[model samples]
Target: MSTAPKTSIIPREVDALKACTQGATYEGVIMPEDLPRLAAAVVSIQREMTGKVRFFRDESNYRMVTAELHTVVSVQCQRCLSALDYQLRAEMDLAIVVSEGQLESLPKEFEGWLLDESGSADLYEAIEEELLLALPIVSYHDQADCSASGQYSTGDFEEPLAEKKNPFAVLGDLKLAGKADSTDKESE
Candidate 1:
């Protein structure tokens, strides 16, 4: 059997971002598998990532891009050891920068968009970075449904941690001894 290739089209051509209509928007969806970095972060890529990139001229007349994206991906639940549907969402407000110095002066509200030497930003790559950033550091199912939820606690089936002594407690005792010795020496 043959399978269709998961191909995507992004605006990364020469001069793709050279000029922008102050208020133009580009919107589309990309299969999760099309984004290698993001695909590698999850167990499976079974959903389409939807997003839109809007171009606007900031007050300084610098090119600004804003993107909003969200998707549902399947990740292995850390607690249940099963596949879980994890929701990922991200919003980006970036100021296109041509020189390294521009990044230092970007407004706090805008993130620096360091375009390559060719002056074009990989549309898919940028979005993929945003998605990866939004992914949970450790994905897990809800407590009510997790196969091993609460089991990691001491009262649960897991072994309890042994009680530990405070290492600094001896310092306090040493201080008391010094004070007592000083008091006796002074009194004598």
Candidate 2:
């Protein structure tokens, strides 16, 4: 696994916005050894990110990280318990603010707006977080994109539109019933 420094605009000014710059394009498979730290942050969401990361940092401390990723995210259909694979396309923009304290904490080589931070910020973590945030909370593979075995279908699942009655309502009714029963007993 190769770790490459982000090639973006240098963070010279501490409190002001600088010119927007783009990072190096990362392409190639990330080995299993490199997956631990990144996987820990992503957990099960790791399946949704696999490809190149093209990042660009702007003058307003806005970092635009784009990835051409391809992965089958595992999702359970709401209608069925069966697991399904959903092809995800994710893109995101992050506003990275570099403080003087954060810059002081980073190594000299890593001294920059995008690199300066509290401790080391993993590139994969940033990429994964951005992608995960862009992803839908619930996703399913469409029938057209499903495997040849007629497995997955977007129609197989349906969201609950009706509001469910609160269980506490039954307790309230029971309390009312008890009150009525006590009144009747007293009358007797």
Candidate 3:
């Protein structure tokens, strides 16, 4: 195992950006093992995404990181109640900040952190946060493609019929008719 940090472009030292100076750019891939928290979060949802990160910094102490991710995710169709696979494409942008306090003490709006005092920045946390934030709150597979088998077809199913019984009808006949009706609908 390489003891070196797995992120490709993180600087070893933290540098202060002057008000009028141009910031630096860092690019790299976040190895899966390097992001345990993030990996766990995604894996818990049973999805896998991998991609590259590009971070740009400005002299005004502002930083922006963009990530392009691709993965296959498992989702249940809301309309069909069936499991399906979905192709996920996600893009995210995050602002970065450098501070000297404990990471927990930082303001809520500070999107990410630069933890070192050596004039370089490590972007592992920032990248992880950005990717997580970009995940969709809800995702579903294409409905058209999901129902080809028609066995688990949602389109053919009707809304639950009202429970009111026909007062004049015989109870046994109604029960049998209801069952036959349901089966006939399924066959259609």
Candidate 4:
């Protein structure tokens, strides 16, 4: 395996096959502004993302890549709708595949990354996808720190109980009327 010199600027495009053959390692900081897709998903980014990506041929002779990323982003709390700083740490182990058919053949331990026709993959896309996956399904600050804590309730908070009609009641009535009309015609 070859060790690549660390660089500050992360390349947007990466030749996965060539990197795998050369056993290249890439590490850098990515500005939040540069990731439009990730920026749009959050309230704001608290800091730049730091990441490392390494490409190499695995023992099974599969072209493989592993990526690790860390970042902090601002996301609205589901409970209070207030901004909360959420730390995201993501790691990925994937086999580089040139076509969709190869995905099904990948080993269970490795997910597949399909390279486009350009023969290179988008470095930012890989990082962004993992980071997005790392985001919490529901974001919230600690109970002690959250302003809207201690207000959770399982019961309804609506006004005093009022009679509610069943949505299917009209259909039931129509059926009853149809039965009554049939009975009347038979009696006639």
Sort the candidates on TM-score, descending order: 4, 1, 3, 2
lDDT of 2 by residue, 65-168 (tens): 45565555555544444466555565544444457665465444342435454323455555555545655665544545434336445366768789989999
Compare the candidates by lDDT and give the number of the best one. Answer: 4
Evaluation by TM-score, superior candidate among 1 and 3? 1
Weakest ten-residue segment in model 2 by summed lDDT: 10-19
TM-score of 2: 0.42
What is the number of backbone collisions in each predicted candidate, taken in the order shown?
0, 0, 7, 0
Candidate 4 lDDT over 45-160, as tens digits, reads: 98889999999998889999898899999999987889999888999888899988888888787888899755598988888988888888888878889888878764667686
| True-structure lDDT of candidate 3 | 0.54
Q: Write the per-residue lDDT of candidate 3 for residues 85-187, one digit (tens) a residue.
A: 6555666665554554544554566554544544354455555566566556665456466554455654576889889987766988889999999999999
Tell me the whole-model lDDT of each prediction, alpha carbons only: 0.76, 0.50, 0.54, 0.88
Task: Report the lDDT tens digits of candidate 1 across residue range 29-146.
Answer: 7775678888788887767887787777778888878889878888999877899987778997778787888888877877887886677667777778888888888888888899
State candidate 3's TM-score. Answer: 0.44
TM-score of each: 0.70, 0.42, 0.44, 0.75
Candidate 1 local distance difference test against the native? 0.76
- The lDDT of model 4 is 0.88
Better candidate by lDDT, 1 or 4: 4
What shift in Å separates residue 149 of candidate 2 from its native position after superposition?
17
